[model samples]
Target: MPHYKKTKIPLLWLRRHTSDREFMLISSVLVGLTAGMAAVILKTLVHYIHVLLAYGNRLLDQPYWLVVFPIIGILLTVFVVRVAFNGSIGRGTAGVLFSISQKSSMVERHKMYSHVVTSAFTAGFGGSAGLESPIVVTGSAIGSNYGRDYHLNYRDRTLLLAAGAAAGIAAVFNAPIAGVLFAIEVLLTDISISAFIPLIISAVVGALCSKLILQEEILFNIGQREFFAASHLPFYVLLGVLCGMMSVYYTRMALRVEELFEEYQSKVYSRAIVGGILLGLLIMLFPPLFGEGYDSIRLLEGNNAQEMLQNSWLAFFGTNEWLVLCFVGALALVKVFAATITIASGGNGGNFAPSMFVGASTGFFFSRLVNLLSFNNLPVSSFAMVGMAGILSGVMHAPLTAVFLIAEITGGYTLMIPLMIVAATSYAMVKYFEPYSLDTKKLAQKGQLLTHNKDRTILRIMKIQHLIETEFQPVSPEATLGELVEVIAHSRRNLFPVVTADRKLDGIILLENVREIMFKTEKYDLVKVRELMVKPPAIVQYDDSMADVMKKFDESGAWNLPVLRNETYQGFVSKSSIFTKYRKLLIKTTNVA
Candidate 1:
């Protein structure tokens, strides 16, 4: 038998030869390519599923089939999650954000393909949702796990995570610029200019994958059009306001519906059944609500709004264009319900596509209404295209991403001015009512949102338990000065906690305060620990937040603070320890590596 020894290279060799930037750039490419491939596969799977289930089929002609297919898709998705994946659908983008903020940019390894399988099943089988979000999750997981495998630091891991997300979004839409902005605006909070290189590289590679392999058509192509005239500015602004209002409604509705489903949290099947039935009925009345509604958006963009309403029950109200316009507007209003229910019912998907769908519908309805009632020939296609940016901006609180994504996908900067106007106006208006985007609200509330602000992000990641020094010895308040002297000699710390017989904190004794009497051993018997101990300016409760702890530290001007639980001494939290931990956390959170 021949024994083979594995060849090994020194870790120092790799670290010495390669710069961190080069390694990150290389990793970004791999992540981009892999994530791009995943996006293509997910999109292709959904296309084939649509072809098999609904396209060119008599089943789609029946209104009842429309009602049944979504139910079946959701049930299949639920089955896959419960049986194969152990009832974990994987948190979509929120999960990605949470990982970046709280989990040290670490995601479950299974997420790389779990979302692909589940979301493909959900959306492909006619569930009313989009694949963009799942792809983002899948991509982020790929990047996160790849970084983890290499034993990369938290900063590099988070950078790769965002790179993967950028690639996924870029590949899905074939819009690389939008992908970069999406990653920067939504996923990455603390980024450096150098970080953009990897993100850009990843996005371009991902977009190339979609363009070269998948040959994905430009999703919403609004053919050559002139820039919006100054005359149309007011209408665009008005449209922005309307979209902003719709965005608010969409956010509130999605959150409320999610809460409603959560009421049956333990009863997954009941939630699925009730949500599916409700979603089905909505689709039955408004056929456009059946799936992602991208096709309906395309119809509106092509000035075929009537075609969207053709299969609806309202088609009986004659082929009236106004009725169709009204129905389109109604779909814009209720599409939020369809989308929220689709996901809330245990289906796998995200709001990325639904937001664009609602935006397109709102723009088309607004433009069409103006064209009918006024002499101004408001370009419906342009508004339809720009409306997507507005709703996307408002819903995601990502105006830059929305604007660039629309400008890129539409194949020109012809609509750039209106896109900016509408998106900015809508975002500003929505910001007045909702501080955080739909995806980030919960994370922000929990202090798990990694914003661009470095200080806050570091503070959020710094755990008080890890910073607390529990090694300080506690001296009984009744202990004689000679006993205190013995404790001080054995202890490594300069501060001592004086506790009662029951372990409750009485006061703290600083070594400096007793330094004068330390050498007077003859008088040691005359001094008692309680007599020398002084009350601290402030004490930190065990459950006190880091913010409160810091505040107490500032107000008291103490080098060390006692941590107590219900008046019982727990440990000592030092200002120096906190500053050291914060410095380390800041380095870890930022792209210092």
Candidate 2:
């Protein structure tokens, strides 16, 4: 022992000295820096791809090539997903949500970079989608894998995963506060006040990264907005209503198109070609639908209406302003199709930016239409700004996020009042028609969504198979009490299932019921197992949901219940085991560490 030398394990030594909170704070900074860098790389890649495609070879001058580029992008993206990545590159934020709810927030390691590569190819070549969702997935994977490598607990892993997502969004938009809200509103459910410190730190770090390195241009730079006009409150309310209705139509149409493509799931090429061709034709008609369409939104906010229509098929109509207005309005309606097809056709992207694009267009269209009527001079730029909040609120069902995001990204709260009004109204209207957002409807329907509710989340993570007690021995109903006594002596469980020769549950024999006669040797021969066995008041089916099983337990008032499948005795489900598992799952689901 005196001759041996020990090698110091730095991480383990640090872990032994540092507290959990200190470790989380350190992890948050690392996640924020990495996620921010990832976001920057994705943006830079997409920009270079766009330059190479549109400006490098005179592709912009060739309208046919512009249409063909997206098809090629979709093909490339599909190829990479199917071959290079083994078809594991997930679809944007939905994948993130699915992982948190169903997979314990454990994202596949490939996602950390797969989305950046494929989405760059898809949108860089002009697929009509946005990079925000892909960035979210990539960042989430980074944080999740980091936590896994460190062997952190589930709560810490999920917190870090969400921190990465917030960081990515903050870096992308240069809006730290909004980033925090987006993470809490969309990705997390049951956040404590203590969690806010890490989230805030990560978001700020990410935003600083974007501000310092990327120098991101202000997305909707509408000069200095006019002060809110109380007279225009009614108009804002009406805009909210219209945006809500449009959101419903948009949600339904997107799901419908996704279903249409899903039919060709077995044939990836068929799906890719069909969706790409349709999207290409749409883009050919409406060049503004070519990509995320943020350029067009900026143009619209700046009142460059003619420039917005400069390169579209609609330009053939005329230079008439009314014609341009009609074209812009039409783009608002069909952009949904372009965006949805871009994604449904196996492109890697999300509906976040597309929704904002639609909102801006809708707001501008409404304001222009009213101004043309001469009812009043509505501020087109302000309405366009608030409209972003309205549609975002409706589609994502996160009104606060929509409102604050609009306020923060625009670099001021000049439109906060209208933002709140429009966002709340649209959210309420959409909530009336659709109970869940586009990303969460399927998960909620399957009872897989883990909201902030601790009880439901605990129940959601508790699997019945893990709680099933298979050690309970079974005996034939035809056996004598002597055989039951032998089983009871050799077994540990107090309840013994009586089954037929076919393994079907005929009844059960409780040890307490035969406790006195169990040791009576004379009665063991005379009393048959069937004579003493009693039918259980209630039985649990193998496929029954936890909610239903809990209800059966309460109604039967039994400590132990028999589990059966098609009348065959499978095993027993004891209350003690369920309680123990519930406590463990509760700790796993709720513990912040």
Best by lDDT: 1
Off by over 4 Å in 2: 1-18, 215-222, 319-322, 452-454, 457-461, 515-522, 591-593
Off by over 4 Å in 1: 1-26, 215-222, 517-523
Full-model lDDT for every candidate? 0.85, 0.84
Question: What lDDT, from 0 to 1, does candidate 2 have?
Answer: 0.84
Query: After aligning candidate 2 to the native by TM-score, how far in Å is the CA of 298 from where it should be?
Result: 0.9
User: TM-score for model 2?
Assistant: 0.92
RMSD of 2: 3.8
Q: What TM-score, computed on C-alpha atoms, does each candidate reach?
A: 0.92, 0.92
Clashes of each: 1, 2
User: What is the alpha-carbon RMSD of candidate 1 to the true structure?
Assistant: 3.3
Q: Which lDDT tens digits does candidate 2 get at residues 1-593?
A: 33212222454565578998898898898899989889888888888788777778878777887668888899999999989888758777778887886677899999999999999988998999988899899889988987887788788999999999999989888888888888989888668899998888888988888788874443233354566899999999999998999888788888998888888888888788888889888888888888778888887787677787778776777668688778888988998899999999888899888899999899999988999889889998888888888988998888888888888877788789999999999999999999889877767767666654557655655666777888888988889989899999899888889888898998999988999888889887788999989999799988887777888999999988989888877888988888888787666555353
